[model samples]
Target: MDETTYKFLMGASAFVIAILGLMLAGTTILPEVGLEKLRKARSILIPSYFVLALLSLVCCLTGYDRRIEPASTLLVASFQALLFTMSMLVFIRPNEVRWKTVFRQAGVITVAGLVLFVSFFRFTDYYSCFFYSGVVAYVLQLIIYTRKFMLAYRKTVQEVEDYYDDDEENRLVWVKCGFFSALAVGIMALSILFFPVLYKYFVPLYVVFYSFMVMWFVNYYRRMKFAIPVIAAMPQEADVCAIPETVLAKTDGVAAEEAVAVAEEAVAVKEEKSGAEHLLKERLQKYIDEKEYCRKDVPSGIVADSFGMSKAFFRQYMKDSYGMDFRPWRKELRLREASRLFAGHPEYTIEEVSEMVGYNNSSNFNRDFKRMMGMTPKCFCKQFQ
Candidate 1:
């Protein structure tokens, strides 16, 4: 087969692989046990993957020529533009399902796409510039979008861990899967940009990476062993035996011995209860001290596993003991840490401080800080200064 055909085939393979991976990752029937949060995430990612796949096809069909037919150029450029815009909107306004941002982004993408599409035929000399510039712009936007998504993922994980009682295991599955998916996409982008010649060769690598993602989802769903609720189980109080006055009066010596045995058993039960409580407290403190809970995206399953408790039980414990849900608790912890970091670490920038306290966006950091501390990071810093 000719080089163009080979490239097209490779692109098609990548597209197929990406689609299959997304289906596996998102579909409930794929034997991948994911929580509701993960399911929602998959819903977003599946379409994103398809857009990326279409872009790859466009690139492959257009070939490496600077002077391509106007029709072909339009197809390639239009797809790239659409892909870039959709990615940005998806990254930014993920929660808004009305397609408002999607439509807006699509408009921008179409304008840019049309310019390149028409320019290919109208001005062959500038084809390289148009193509390369559009690619670079798309890549840049993708990088920003990916970073934002990663941050959002972390926050979601943290919220899941703090608020939900059951499905701790499932939460971790989703977080880890999402993290690796983003990482894989980033790596693919870097390879395509920096090593264009090797792009065709990397088809197998993409296949492998996505295959693992699918497998992970399938395995996680099948196990589904981590569905313990947080508040469902309370420690039972030990029964205290009451002795009748007649028995005690008639038995004399035997009665005294029986009473002593009962006292010993009661003492043992109390000690056991105290020890259990102490162990739980120590575990909880360790979780806090490690700073894992501070991550915006940490899932409750991870924390529950760390404490050797079921997710439901952990949720109940946090509610009963802390009197707040997981998200609020994490927010409170992050803000407190951000405050301390701001006061003590004068050398760090506000951005750095925000990241250290588990914030992905500086704007979010500032907003959360002001809401919690009643001032911006700069103002808070002035107090320490």
Candidate 2:
């Protein structure tokens, strides 16, 4: 490419990068979601945009110098690495990530990338080989992470499913789309290795795509109240089914009378808790028999409140007793009601059955029915006829 054309391309990229950086800066500071982990992850984009802007500046300064090309490749690789790291922070459980460890790893990566950039350009005669090797490494890492991300994505979807009955809205399936889109765009960006001339055109498009993704992610998660309760070390209430080991241990040195009293008190507490659990179980079964779960969009908090329990405790009780989360357990009740309706009222249409069973979306109802019953609703109904 001519010097005039190269300068114009670099100038345009610099202007675009500056605009993109400003937009990212505004969002990072005033993100729509108040989640601390998400906010921290978005903050990483601030430096990413700056890295991009700096890369554009460097390209302009070096103006097609083949030796400096390796440096530019390394910069792009580093940016991609940061992006993948940010996504890992976004998808994983907030408490699972250690930001200090992440920062330390990032520091190591930056230093290694710098060393490679300088060593290959200044000392080695194998600049071309180094550039190709870097590209190969980046692609290999991307492929490996993409597979890992698939597993994480499925687990996240299952977590969401465990909370919300309406799988159509709550399953974080859109995140998978966003992930693969970014992967495609990253691959396109790396194509600069083979087609350097197209970089001038591609960079602007890449910037715009990334900007759209940022807005979509922020807006969607802002309205979503996604939560997965962490398990506690001990039950919150003093009334528990089992006595703490500490209680029994502390009785070793006590007088025989005191020890007997402690043992008797513990037994009383245990019996009280056991009776309460049995009563709760009976009340819940009666609630199910009445088909209270057939109500549309009943909040779990309200359901728990009716039973004089907190939502977290109610959910834990359901999991422990039924071997399933609240939503899944509710789903089973709904589907069972639907099956009964199909058998007893064969005149009912699929949509009617779905609505009666608390499913607003017939498509989702059919999907879930077929998955559980191993046949579609229409086919299931025909069995009775």
Candidate 3:
């Protein structure tokens, strides 16, 4: 690419990147339950892009088109580090983002990256060595980030599975796609530094890719904000699934009340508690026996309401009694019923059996079945035959 053409494209890239920053700015109101950190991350991100645009314009004007200057090197390294760190903050331990620690870590890393960046700069003959070494370090950094992000992604998937029965919408798959796409873009961006022949192609591609990333993030955040309530109302201490009558009978009465009053109060409390527990248990058993879980995807809130229990309390109850979360428990029930259906109705297609077992998507049904049963639906059917 010629000097004039490269400069024009770089200028356009800067403008597009700045516009993308503004697009990110518009999503500032997307923070929802358990995701306050995303707002802070976005706050850092918007300014970072503006800084990127300024750097781009500066490099373009100075004819440091190949990015050989120390200033350009430092700025690019800092931007890449910021991107990686912010991504780690969002995905790894989202709620526990400590700005002080993050700043400190960034400071330490910046010093180290500067040292590596200038290792061969003083020796003009070894500039090639310096450039390739920097690329090696960038590749290593990406490898580390990818591994950590993948581990975090797996944990996030487990949490999503545990919390939502359907889980189709809440899986954070877009975030994973964005993360890997950023790494892929980073590789392409690095190539532009090595081979100026590719700069013209890459600069425009980077602008389009980043704009898509910003939009994807905004859409995902908006969906998350709507899917999860802003505040989960925790159940009060008095609110419980099944309070034991024995515990209620031992509570002290008011100072003015005599022993007889205390006894009478305890007896009334025990009767009320017992009656409520009996009714709820009967309803719960009926819910189970009638195979209500097989009808459709049921959220914990609905299940809790049917038992006249709070959502939080019901989740805890499931954890305590069943040693698993509601989704997994419900999944087991549906899968077992599916197995039975598969054995009895050899004529049923995998999709038909999946729908009968409350799985709206056959793909999810296949995935879950393979995960649980150690084989595909087709393979399982073959065993039955």
Best by the TM-score measure: 2
- Write one digit per residue (lDDT tens) for candidate 1, span 1-385: 2477547755776578667756665556432322433455455546656655665566676655423432343343344333433332222233422356545766776787777777776887886788777767666656665565566555544433444421233334554454445455545645554445654555666556556555554564443333222212233354222211122233455677788776776677667655655666788777679876556444566666666665555565568778976656776787898888877777788988877877655776787789888888898888877
TM-score of every model versus the real structure:
0.41, 0.67, 0.65
Error of 2 at 142 (Å): 3.1
- Model 1, stretches more than 4 Å misplaced? 1-26, 29-98, 164-194, 209-385
Model 2 lDDT tens row, 132-235: 66667677767866876777666655644433445744335556766776776677767765677776666666666667656654564443444323111122
Mark the regions of model 3 whose C-alpha exceeds 4 Å error after superposition.
64-78, 88-93, 112-133, 165-170, 226-281, 285-362, 366-385
TM-score preference between candidates 1 and 2, better one: 2
Model 1 TM-score, all chains together:
0.41
Could you tell which candidate, 1 or 3, scores higher by lDDT? 3
Model 2 residue 158 lDDT score:
60
Error of 3 at 52 (Å): 1.2
lDDT of 3 by residue, 304-373 (tens): 7878876665666678767987788888888989999999988999999998988867888999999999
Ranking by TM-score: 2, 3, 1
